[model samples]
Target: MRLEDLLPSPEPVRFVAADGTETPAPAGHVRPSDELLVEAHRRMVLGRRFDTQATALTKQGRLAVYPSSRGQEACQIAAVLALRDDDWLFPTYRDSVALVARGLDPAEVLTLLRGDWHCGYDPAAVKVAPQCTPLATQTIHAVGLAEALRRKGEDGVVLALIGDGGTSEGDFHEALNFAAVRRAPVVFFIQNNGYAISVPLAQQTAAPALAYKGVGYGVVSEQVDGNDLLAVLSVLTTAVQHARSGRGPYLVEAHTYRMEAHTNADDATRYRDEAEVTRWAAADPLARLQTYLRHRGLIDDEAVRTAEDEAEAFAAEVRTKLNADVVADPRTLFDHVFAEPTAQLVEQRAQLVAELDAGEA
Candidate 1:
């Protein structure tokens, strides 16, 4: 077959316009119910608020650093909501909102960002892998876990989240190749937020779209307007269903922009123009989704206020917990590393305890 015949179409699948108008979903797309739509809206609102609060915490030194998902809430929330309880989520550091949406505690989800030793929550209990810091590494773990489930005859799917920058990682290619060859039940959701820190997409890859990379691996690939909540939800839900039904892996490249700097430590002004940021801000996922919900009479001023109130409560709770003193036990460093501590680890732990005791004396 010709290369053209093997590629996914260039057009992204979208069900909502930038102006918040309803567009027809592609044929066979199942429209979400009013309840699901409302719930999604609530989560989006809460996600944005959570991001705002977390960013503030970074400024106040409550958090070591934060990669704000300010403009990417729709993609994060929709990805998690599309998964089943038994499904696994492998997230990057920027995916705290996704974890929270998956029913993990917000404060616990931020534990890593809070400069804690280990991931705050138990991954096994929540079916979420630790928020991976090394780019694209989690993709390999995700494919391996999915393949293991398939081998064991377990009905579980894995959703692996990566950024535009991660697409350039070698692990990303390896994971896609393995998933395609093994027919692993996994979905690779790439949030193309236009930058990997100061580097822009044009400099990242010359591929027509990141989804095209998946096509080369013989994986079903598609793109969506990541800022549109309904569009993201629809596309991700379809991909999740496909994976769960014993179909091979799918790749979704969500076209979105990061409205904030890469993290608390970087200056976005150095890399991007203010007008460009303004253009994306106009297409803000939260604003567009609110407009759609209000236009359809699915939400009202009262509902908006209620959502805002709930978001504030969530922010307040996170703030209170984060501000409280957390006593760190130095011994915890040796825990969970091995079934039994090595002799070297035992000696190191004893030396650390002795140093602490000496300092106290």
Candidate 2:
């Protein structure tokens, strides 16, 4: 087939509306089970609760800074639900919600914000990479890992999550090109939250959609309403199927809105208008999903109240643990840098210990 034929077009697929309406999935697509739907809702609630706690802790000076995933829980939960436990996940710094959905603990995640080690577990243990801060770099790492897995005859996919601003980066392009050329088993999940730390998506690209960029590298792609969990789940399921079936990489542009500032250190109001925030708030995923579920008689006031209570309890527990735990040793920072510490690193560790003994910062 021609390269153009192999590339994904810019058309979008949507299975839900902003007003809590449902649309049918494609004929071949399968609907998720009720159990999965309930689980998805639980995960989203937990993620939002965790985000709220983290933000409060940041404001109270318990954490360095926090990036809220306020309006993006559905995006992460849906994408994560579409994956198998064995599939790998590469997440960006702002995607701890996605990591949480993939079974990462909230207290362990808060450790990173506490200025401790990268995270509490081996990334390979849960098949989720450590959250990458240098935007878009994880794309390259994900592609390489997928390529290695493919060579080893493994039957799993790698879902690489990135921001829209990352789409403009060379690493994004390089990863897509490499994945396409090698037919690596991976999915490029672009969370286009309309802004990259105050830079709107329009400023980052002139393309009609970020997913269209995949066309340049012959990767199949699709765009969907990231706020609609059902829609995101459908698209991600398709992408996973494609990768598992040896169709190589797929690019998924999840159209979401960032309801909060980029991070605790950011002031989004300086760049975005209040009217825009108001508009997006009307389409809030959690509210819309609640409306839909209630309409379907699958949820009630008591159920919602119960969910709220459960979420609050979970958040409180995490906060208690995070605050009560003893601070990690500063010396352990040098331990994970290398499998075998270099002479220079050994010297650096000694210097750090000496400084600690001297009661210096």
Candidate 3:
């Protein structure tokens, strides 16, 4: 391709207006099918409910911390739904919503945050990396994994999910550079939720758009209206196809918002005014998509009701599981750390086993 083709447009790729009207998209950017959109809508609904349940659990002392993705449902769900099951997902700590949308058990998705043990689910089994906490670090891991997959002649594409603030990290830059140079099959999906903790986007980076950051690395990039599910799904579908075809890595920056504070521990009122929150709420992803589908007659009242019921049921199941007593084996600490246990780990496991035996005696 050409150098000019690597640059992202200043305006975000959009298909649905904020008011639920269908808009025209650029020629090559195909709108996702109706069936996919409806399924995406249901998952988006379920994802938001899951996020709410997790936050409530945090407040009830059932969880340690929850970085809610309340307003970013479209980005969270669309990112996972766009990929094939064989494709890999590298998620950030706040991406539990995305993890659940990817069909991971909610309880297992929260294991790390709950402080129960290491990654609750096997990364290899599900194609999802452990939910990473440090900013932009997962991008490097995603790139490395993508390169390994490429070297092994696998068809899997990797998508690394990040927040806007993570773009400032050195790892994020390094990953983009390496992936671009090596033509790795990775897509960097940035959820520009307007803040890194209390820091707003304005304070984070002066770049016209985070998508533009990929240009210097020669990675093709795109910006999308993240609140519009149709737009997000469309852009990501194209990005994944571009990477899977061996063209190189792609970068996507979704312009979205975080309605809730950074986490339950954060005081959002100190940094942002209610007026800004109210404005974004007017463009809520769930409300917008539901309106669009209803207008198109794609989903009827019964369909909407069924989706709500499913979401409620999903939340209830998560709550029940989290409330139940946990049975954990201390020996698991030494497991999953390596494919083959090192001598030191073997020695440490023996010492722990002896201590447990003595305590029981």
Candidate 4:
């Protein structure tokens, strides 16, 4: 089939609706186990709560700044769940939910956004690299990591997440090309949220579909409804299996929407309209999942209240810990600069200390 035929259109895979409706799974993809569905629901709820509380903290001066993933929960959770423990994760700034679901602690994850170190947890410890904010640079790292693991005869893959905006960067193509040549065990997960900040996909690329970009480099590819949790999960599961089983890298373009401001610093209201926000809100991921759960008798009003209470407490605790933790000294930045400090680095450090002592603003 021609790649253009798979690009997103008005009608894509949709499961739960804000008002509660179910969509059937695509052919060749079996219905997931009940346990997996429940877990997906829990993770999405937690992720949404975490993002909302973090944003609130940033607004109240408790946190530095926040980049929200309001309407992209299905895309995030589906991909993360598809990975094995040994597999690696390459995340972007908006992938906090995925990171947490992959087991990153919320308190530790916040340290990065708070202008501290990368993340308190070691990337190697959890197989998740620090959130890369420099566009598609992490795509290169993902390719490299996957290639290394493959060369060593390791049985694992790398799952790299990027926004549609990232496709415009040279690094994205370069990484894809390198992964293709090496047959790296990796999957490039692209969440097409319409806008790369304010730049829409139409302005970013003329390619028939982002997934088609894989065709140029012999990468296997697929397109899934980013808003449909079931579709996202099924597609990612197959993609991961393909990579792990040595079929080469896979590209999954999830067509989704970004319902909130790009970041706390952004004014989405400037580029988009209120009607759009209302429309997307009505198609929220959590609402549909809850509706499904309720319909299946898996959750009820009491369970909903209990989940909200737990999420609220968790958010409150995260704020308290963030405020209470000892802020790292500014001088410690120099400690990790080298194995042994260079003479020039030593001199620079002394100069900085002297300036601090002199109270030179």
Structural similarity to truth (TM-score) of each candidate = 0.96, 0.93, 0.97, 0.90
Assess each prediction's global lDDT (C-alpha) against the native.
0.91, 0.84, 0.92, 0.83
lDDT of 4 by residue, 106-209 (tens): 88888788877766668888999989999999999999999999999998999999999999999999999999888899999999998999987899889777
Model 1: residue 255 alpha-carbon error in angstroms: 0.2
Model 4: colliding residue pairs: none
Better of 1 and 4 by lDDT: 1
The segments of candidate 4 whose C-alpha lies over 4 angstroms from its true place after superposition are: 1-19, 346-361
- In model 3, where do residues sit more than 4 Å from their true spots? none
Best prediction by TM-score: 3
Off by over 4 Å in 2: 2-11, 24-29, 347-361
Q: What does candidate 2's lDDT look like per residue over 141-175, in tens digits? A: 99999999999999899999999988888999999
Error of 3 at 353 (Å): 2.0
Q: Which stretches of candidate 1 lie over 4 Å from their true place?
A: 1-6, 351-361
What clash pairs does model 3 have? Answer: none
